[model samples]
Target: MSRFLFISCLCTLLLACQHSPKKNYFYLSPISEKTVTQTSSNVSSQLIGIGPVDIAEYLTSSQIIDNQSDNTLTMSDNAYWAEPLDKSIARVVSLNLTQLNNGRSFVNFPWRSDSKPHYSLRLHVDTLSRTGKNANINATWELIDNDAKKSILRRNFLRSIPAESGAKGLAYAYSQLLAELSKEMDEALNQNP
Candidate 1:
């Protein structure tokens, strides 16, 4: 009787799961597509290298994170990132900056060994989470001028993105963050140069 009961219970659980909805996947997207290019005009531009986007360990997951409270988080197993969040963010940021000011040279990190960038941008993203209704990113970035061996810009930014429909909304919010950051970084570089 015990063996029969256990088998019946296991079969019922398996059948219930079969009726569950399929898992959904999400991917982060910046604005539009962009490519790193050479300057065609006589503009005083600095070679900017962007890299090493350090994200919070908790958020470094395939699943999208929802902040339930100040100290608690919920991960949706059915809704997840199509790719690693960190890599997507880096790609979006670099692409946004490159497109924001195409006149300037922008390169991803791990460039040629001999390449000497006039400036380098490093980012540390502390909060890239969603509340389901809104998305937010809080981060600090540093711009270092290698030629001068000094830091030109170190700014902390916090922005809220009004989003909906879960993962898509979060992706939009993330893209906006990149857009804002690129604009500010470009302006700062202009001021320093």
Candidate 2:
């Protein structure tokens, strides 16, 4: 009878494991596919050094965070970023910025030792809030001239976009927000850089 009970429990556990849903993984993709044509007259492809991006402490995790209520935040263990979230943002932002520039040189931060960037861009993400079907990113970015020690431009950009409802949709919203930021940065670079 003990043997029979053990077999039944083992079968139950195996069946339960088998019936569990598979975990889903997601990644953020660049907004630009291959190349961004130089259509905007002010666009310059000068090498821009972007890096050391700072993310909010709460958002610095693999799990996608969702604010279910004013005091409740939900994190999905099953839905995770394929890579670190901060690194992914850098890649996506680079893709967007490259298109805005007329030059072909865009470099991520911690660049080659000998490389000299035209402008150094830094970003601090204040909030990447996904409250409901809508998502938004509130970030502040600054640009500095490589040759000069003075600050070139600083601004806060906030954009809201539609999110699908899951990880995939959230990624879509983030991509859109990055594209908006790219456009703004392009304008800043063109103004006097």
Candidate 3:
């Protein structure tokens, strides 16, 4: 009994010492400053959705240490959150909309306008979680029609990255998320023509 307790205590101390906290920070970077280009199918006037939304912001929480694990991100630097992921998603969506057509853009939500749009696109995002096991991020994306006020498309993006604490994981996960989101958006929007 004594031997078992001593071994466990020693192991605990060793782990606590080995796992040093890092100065980590992450931000989702824009793919590029240039506007995304799409060939306009409709020549007529269109007023599209732009956003400063009332939707809930992105949320994040951390899990306590489970065991000693080292991954590429952590081995390189300390972990920390930077420039919330939710905001990045919003920006990406806005950018993509701008690229979709020669339509005017506005940041106001509830999607009302003096000039009516041919179609209105609104996105509601839920569950951008990063889990400790394999550092996976799971997100559900919904595209709604402002005129109809109902969902036209709902899709989930799930990605797994190496488990690294802090900003590294966030950045890696976000990049993956953006790629997935953009791809899906392109397909949906382009499907019209």
Candidate 4:
């Protein structure tokens, strides 16, 4: 009967599909490298100060909230194409500071100062989120006068990064962002007396 033949063919097809091995693939595109811009060799030796950044205690476990809603995606899940909110950003900030100071002197936070410094830096990273085609980094940089207990310099730095599709792409974007931040910091410090 045609009905019997049709049922038999369906069962054979189902069995074949069930027996087929499942396949998983990860596609990563080639990431383009960006070059660092060279700045003038002239730099001041004034020892600037800095307080600890108030980043999330468990950055790796943190997530970025959706722009449309309060929904957050864990850094782990986002790691498929990019880095999470972990130590990577912190490390980038540290490197920027070191490079800015020219590696001569950098005082750690929880500072036990014997004397007042020329200027103290306090940073608050309010948001570091990723949108559809861009990553948004918003931060407040404050330069406090140790003796005055008041801010001498304050600026908000916001960077918009083109969305990266892969892990390498994410890294490349962060690197570029860090470089821009460093430039901004340098200019801020230079304007200070």
Note the Cα lDDT for every prediction shown: 0.76, 0.78, 0.52, 0.57
- lDDT per residue for candidate 3 within 103-186, as digits (tens), equals 435353444456555454444544444446454445565555666776677676666656445545556555656655666765
True-vs-predicted CA distance for residue 5, candidate 3, Å: 44
What order do candidates take by lDDT, descending? 2, 1, 4, 3
In terms of lDDT, the poorest run of 10 residues in model 3 is 64-73
Q: Where does candidate 2 clash, by residue pair?
A: 44-102, 45-102, 45-103
C-alpha lDDT (0 to 100) for residue 67 of candidate 2: 49
Q: Could you give candidate 2's per-residue lDDT for residues 1-193 as a string of tens digits? A: 9999999999999999998877777877766655455554434445678876889888877878754458577987588788887888888888777666646466888788788787788889988878777888999999978678667888999888778887788877888888888878877776764
lDDT of 1 by residue, 29-130 (tens): 655644333233246454788866788898888878755466789876588888888788778877777666666776777667688687888888998877
Q: On TM-score, who's better, 2 or 3?
A: 2
Using TM-score as the measure, which candidate wins?
Answer: 2
**lDDT by residue (tens digit), candidate 4, 20-126:** 86432222221122333334324444555656565443333333333321555434234332334433454455456556445224454556757446676777766
TM-score of each: 0.78, 0.82, 0.53, 0.60
Cα-based RMSD of the predictions, in order? Answer: 4.1, 3.1, 10.0, 9.5
Higher-TM-score candidate of 1 and 2: 2
Off by over 4 Å in 2: 1-20, 32-37, 40-45
Give the number of the best model, judged by lDDT.
2
Model 2, global lDDT: 0.78
Question: Candidate 3: deviation at residue 72, Å?
Answer: 21
